[model samples]
Target: MCGRYATTRSSGTLSQLFEAYDDTDGRHRPDWNVAPTKPVPVVRVDDAGERALSLARWGLLPPWATSPSAGARMINARSETVATSRAYAGPFARRRCLVPADGWYEWARTDGGKQPYFLTRADGDVLALAGIWSVWRGPDGPWLTCSVLTTAATGALAGVHERMPVLLPPTRWEPWLAPTGDPSALLGADEEWLAGLEIRPVGAAVGNVRNSGPELTARVPDVPAPRRAREDPRSTAEMPLF
Candidate 1:
């Protein structure tokens, strides 16, 4: 459910951080409000089994899709069923990738309106979101695409939303992007890692994709409306795996 996020790093910077060669060909630009259908940077193993930083459309288009528009709804793949889902099974087994983001935006319902919150690493490190990709051969040429993976939100995130992107730690990044492995083993939320995230209430400017900049991530005063009660933490364990 990570519909909007920020990734302002250059391809070169990401290449160095992820230890992947830059294959984006300098087409990448800083994006503070990435939306569906936009191109995004993804780190994956190339044909030679070496990691490469490449640009992929935000949504995933299965090889058999007739229209590129189908990608909109395919922006996120639920971790629990990705291995068996028709549109994701193949990519889950062979085309796993790491989606680097500065942070993600989640909206919490309030009496007045929806309040947007920005969740990022407390240490200011980038988040390597779990992802799967596919190469769709269209009439023009091959279209590279990808989808973020989501799981039941745990720890502090559950209060904001029942689901969140599968954020991978550095220790699990290699296992996730490896050619093969039981992805399910790595889908669970790591409490230690989750505790490192800082959730800041930010202005609603982020809700509009057209607005982009450091200001979008700046903290703002909480709405005066009654804040929703913290969702029962115990309910997290029973939440359906996304």
Candidate 2:
């Protein structure tokens, strides 16, 4: 499960890469360790059929949910049941979105302990983790929540973990972003695309949400004890996702 990841791209670069209109409410700080429940950038087709780069709470809250807190556990939806699951079927049919990430973090158990690794495209392409979203209303107001889709890992990733986010390829981006019916055809894991992926061990600091820096993702030989991550007072609140 992708409980932690990084999205260190500048807003300008992502706007052009996804050809999306910048819809974030304010400046988004680069995050090397993004955790669930935090608002992260997402690219999706608006009703106008134009791709818009917007922020969304990382956890998905079904439209019928009674409490916003339910979102935390809904951070990832399994691919096998997404089309039929009560919580995800509606969004799968109409609210598809592409989650932007430089890469994601996955931990592997070894003789020493659990070691974290950062996975990214070998050519440095941004990962569009397939996602579904919902618009939920509560006492506070309406919220745009999203969940990343996961499938059994295939390729180098398989040795790391049995499941990983369904990373979308550029060729399918247009169709997947179309605001229409279910696009299950475009939601499967792609080994051909995964062939170009690169994985490397990084500091254990990434396990801490307080960590925010390029060094957290810096490749390390073998992480023994990760350095303590500094805290950001303003980070606890989700960033604006307009």
Candidate 3:
């Protein structure tokens, strides 16, 4: 599961990258360790069909939820069952969004314990993670929240964990955010696209959300894997989406 990640790009840059109008109102800041329940930037089309970049709580809160605390456990929805899950069906049908991130963190289970690894595009391109959003109204007002969709890890990613966030390529971005788009067709991880990614071993500093900065993503000394060996795709450039 993608429990932590990094998003240091400014709102202006994100607005330009996604070609969406900024709706964040200048409240977002660079975060290296993004945790659940925290506000995250999401790109989605409004009711008028105009794409907009806005902030939503990282955890999704279904309309039936009685309190905000329920969101913490709903941080990620399994892509295989998102369209049928009681808590995700509605949002998966109409509230699809793109979650922009520089990269995401995953922990590999090892004999010593769990070792952290950072995954990102070798070209340094931003990742548009597939996500679904919801709006829950309380006595105060309407609260916007979202959850990232995770699919079975494919290719080299499986060596790190059994699951990884569903990354949408540029060609599928519009369709992914479209209300009528078929989600299942775009749920799998493309191996050609996956070939462009580089998985680097990083320090344990990222284990603590309180620690922030570029240091958290800096590559550390390589260690022999107790699990499956991680493949290096540095020679492979990112290819077009299939």
Candidate 4:
């Protein structure tokens, strides 16, 4: 599960990268530790059938949900049941979106303890994490929310975790946004295509959301995992979404 990640690109850069117009209220400040329930940038096809960059609440709230708080638990949708889950079936079929991230954090259980690792593309390109969105209506207005989809971890990533976020390649981006009946074909074995990715050890500072800046992502040598950051219950990046 992808509970935390980073997105530091500017709106202008993202617009050019996706070839989509920007319709977000404003650019999100660069964050090294993004947590659930926070607003994040997303690219999706609007009602006019045009791709647009917008801000969406990270937690997904289905229309049938009674309250917005329900969103907190819906941060991620498992790929195996995404097409049929009661809370995700509708959005998965018609409201697909792309979650842009510079990289994501995963904890690797080592002999010392669970160590945090940062995973990103070796080429330093943005990752389009496959996601689904929803618009929940309320008296005040509409609330835009979304959830990242996670599939069985494969190839290199499988060694660290059992599941990882579904990453859509550039050539398959448009095909995924189609409002077709079923898109299982797009989820077919994609491990070999992700060989360009690189994973490395990063400082435990990333475990605390309050601890920001480049220091959080700096590569560090192997050492004992610090206890403070990992023990902080509010630390977003260190939280296990599973």
Candidate achieving the largest TM-score: 1
Model 1's C-alpha root-mean-square deviation from the true structure amounts to 3.7
Please provide, for model 3 over 74-108, each residue's C-alpha lDDT reduced to its tens digit, 9 standing for 90 to 100: 99999989989999999999999999999999887
Model 1 C-alpha lDDT per residue in residues 1-242, reported as the tens digit of each score: 88999999999999999999999988999998999999999999999999999999999999999999999999999998999999999999999999999999988876667888888887789999999999999999999999999997775577677789999999999999888778889988787777778777789889888998999988787454214324454433322111
lDDT of 4 by residue, 1-242 (tens): 88889888887788889988998767567788888898899999999999999989999998888888999999999989998999999999999999999889888766677788777887789999999999998678899999999997765566566678999888778888877746777876465457767766787788887776767667777554434334434323322222
In model 1, where do residues sit more than 4 Å from their true spots? Answer: 224-231, 235-242
The TM-scores, one per candidate, come to 0.93, 0.88, 0.92, 0.89
Q: After superposition, how far is residue 129 of candidate 3 from its true place, in Å?
A: 0.6
lDDT of 3: 0.87
lDDT of 2: 0.80
Could you tell me which 10 consecutive residues in candidate 1 have the lowest summed lDDT?
233-242
Q: Considering only N, C-alpha and C atoms within 3 Å, which residue pairs clash in candidate 1?
A: none
Cα shift from native, residue 61, model 3 (Å): 0.4
Query: What tens-digit string does per-residue lDDT give for candidate 2 at 1-242?
Result: 78888998877788899999898866666788899999888888787877888888999998788987899999999998999999999888888899889899988765557878888876778999999888889889988899999997764466567788988999888788776645888876565677777777777888888888889877877444211111222222221111
Number of backbone-clashing residue pairs for each candidate, in the order shown: 0, 0, 0, 0
For every candidate, C-alpha RMSD to the true structure in Å: 3.7, 9.2, 3.9, 6.4
